[model samples]
Target: MSTYTPGESFAHRLDPRSKLAVQAGFAVAALAHTTVPGLAVLTGVCAAILLAARTHPARALADLRLLLPFLVLLPVVEGATLGPPWFSVADARAPALASYRTLLVVLVSVAYVRTTPVRESRAAVQRLVPGKPGRVLGTGVALVFRNLAVFRGDLRRAREASAARLGDERPLVDRMRLVATAGLARALGRTETLSLAMRARCLSWNPTLPPLALARVDVPVLALACTLFTWGLL
Candidate 1:
């Protein structure tokens, strides 16, 4: 999904630090539970968070399309490897639980990503972590998130151009190779240009991040997050 969708929802107004905390705590708690009911509760909480964030369910599902094949294959592979029967319902439980937990984590992360801006994320990290190192780490992280969309766009355009030129006549492998080459070239070029720009601007080890303020609305969300996390742990 787009790292940050512009919205006026309560989630969008919450501090990024709160979102990060909730995501981390929820992930840790969710992983400890293996039961279907427990996972279902965790998934429900994530879904509620998404709803609170005003995130479109369709958009979230669309973003996960890239992982659908892996999600489908993981349970199958896990079930097959565990026992004699290739598709035992018993064998599938563990894998299914694991996959469900993973999905919950992704959903929580998507909620944070959709609501918080990259700058806010950086500021959150910076505030939580003291010193120049925190600044460096936070800036690095924000830059990565910022650049991810650009990289995706580059790959997409490259593939589209390749397809248009070749008209699907070329073999799949050839098309993939061409796309990969183009994407790598574009990434490298971007890196070089970015490096030069940073150098010209006199890159600092400790860049300033904008300040983040948590308001009253964040309290209820924080409380909900804590409740969910504790529930998952129990």
Candidate 2:
């Protein structure tokens, strides 16, 4: 849900590739270091990344609210047992750490998403990867970034419309069905519209994109990424 906003923050000025590298490195590190001490260090790193992006931790967590339930559920499901004890704390610890690691990775990613523009992200992807496959992946990334907010809005509207019709009074399953069906229909309609718009604009794989250049400032950022990657490997 965190979209790019025009800003002069450190993260905004850094090349998208650097940001992407940090995200990748952080994910690797988080996965490699799932211990309490490791997570504590990563949490501090995550906070620093958020600060660099000029994003608040609360806002980042709020944006990721949709995923929180599943994160919370994972440990619970893992801990639950069919025996008399019903639950095992030892069994839950590993999954709980894993879930926390996942959260840290996602929070780091939120910084990238918030600071990097969709086009820059696409360009970075295409640059990192070459040729037709890269173009296709870049196109997919651009479309997803651009359309996600619109799709979220469509779903919100659908839900509000359903509520206006007293749909909330219906059974939970019925309400879910109505909202889901409406959202799906709207998504299909939007997909068709997007296709037509692309055709009208003559969407091409070789379209001009904003140039990406790493500045002197990016050196430290890249170094940080490398450090994280090396730490993960160690």
Candidate 3:
């Protein structure tokens, strides 16, 4: 289990793997339908998932903030690849659809992670990968979740160390290069150690054993969610 205790609300009661299936359905539906209205509906569904999970509003907002950088970038690509006016019905549609798709996937993932144990999520994700991808991602989940605070502190210390060494005389570009190199080296070292430690601790992903079972009753609920998303996509 990760130090990050996922909220145990109504939504958390569902099987972790089931929620992931629903996310796959939503993602498929989002890709199938590209209109603004369709995307809005999908975004609303994502918001509803968040609400149902009963996650903290502040945390949800923070997650939204994570999407900000992408929000700024999505429009430029939409305009260049899709068309002219940034705000037009035709031009904005691609970006709007993209924004909503990104939001939907992110929110679903957040809700799932916030509900399931980090290890359980890792195990579920393993089902998707063929050979090495599963193990690699599972390793990330274990190390990243278990030592999240430490990793964050490492990043902060690295940045501060860079800042302290940076003088007014140094060019901004040079400072950035130095900071990037320092941060990358430190991050790589930490990850390598963590990976080795994880292996020593005997971590492996066997997806057959879920922390919670998908109850017989839960199947219809997932089926309903899938049906709704599928119908709307059409």
Candidate 4:
């Protein structure tokens, strides 16, 4: 499960709804400020949040690795589009800001995911969103968190099994295709099992989720969210 680490930090104690509000606030706030200094503030706040939650910095950077190549490519492509000397700060600024904004968003999201369990996340969505849309979205989020670890394990096993069979001699594209196919098949099988289990349990439209309630600790988090919105307005 995507779960909370054992901790007593303020962020760890804040209500999931409050954290969700702050996360949404951060995303909206990020859009308002694209300048380097503005982005620095946003990035700093995200980092601080992660730190407050006692998450390791290395883990935070590791979470960012998947997007690093794209982040690097975007600015280069934008700058190169300007011809000759092939480096226009003016042309590159937008792409750079966009990439950094994405990084900030991911960092904050990682902090949230690490500190909240899949169960709390599902409950947060259901309570905050309401009705059919809430149920659909909550289920989707829950499934993603629940299955991500399983998919990762499947991927690792596929790589090991491929290596055992001298699959390294195959072209990169072929190797990737094989692994992808294996992973998808496993995922489908897992899904079928889960569906059957749910059906056996009388799959209801309303699956019971644990209660998420606001507490005294949420006051500060809500305040921070309000501050973020105000800053975004400015």
**Which of candidates 1 and 3 reaches a greater TM-score?**
1
Candidate maximizing TM-score: 2
Output candidate 2 Cα RMSD: 1.1
TM-score of each: 0.90, 0.97, 0.73, 0.90
Report per-prediction Cα RMSD to one decimal: 2.3, 1.1, 4.5, 2.1
lDDT per residue (tens digit) for residues 20-71 in model 3 = 7777787777777667677777777777777878765468657567466787
Candidate 1: regions farther than 4 A off:
80-86, 232-234
lDDT of each: 0.82, 0.93, 0.68, 0.84
| lDDT per residue as tens, model 2, 1-234 | 878888999999999999899998998898889899999999999999999999998999999988999999999999999996999999999999999999999899888999989999999999999999999999999999999989989989999999999989999999889989999999999999999999999999988999989999999999999999999999
Q: How far is candidate 4 from the true structure (C-alpha RMSD, Å)?
A: 2.1
- Output the TM-score of candidate 4: 0.90
Give a tens-digit lDDT track for model 1, residues 161-233. 9888873689888888898999999999999998999899998766666678888987876887787677656
lDDT of 4 by residue, 1-234 (tens): 234566687777878999988988898899998888889888788878988788776787786776779998999888885457768888888998899898888788878888887888888888878999998998899888888878878988998899899998999999999999998898899989999998898866688787777999899889989989888888
Lowest lDDT 10-mer window, candidate 4? 1-10
Return the lDDT, model 3, position 229. Answer: 72
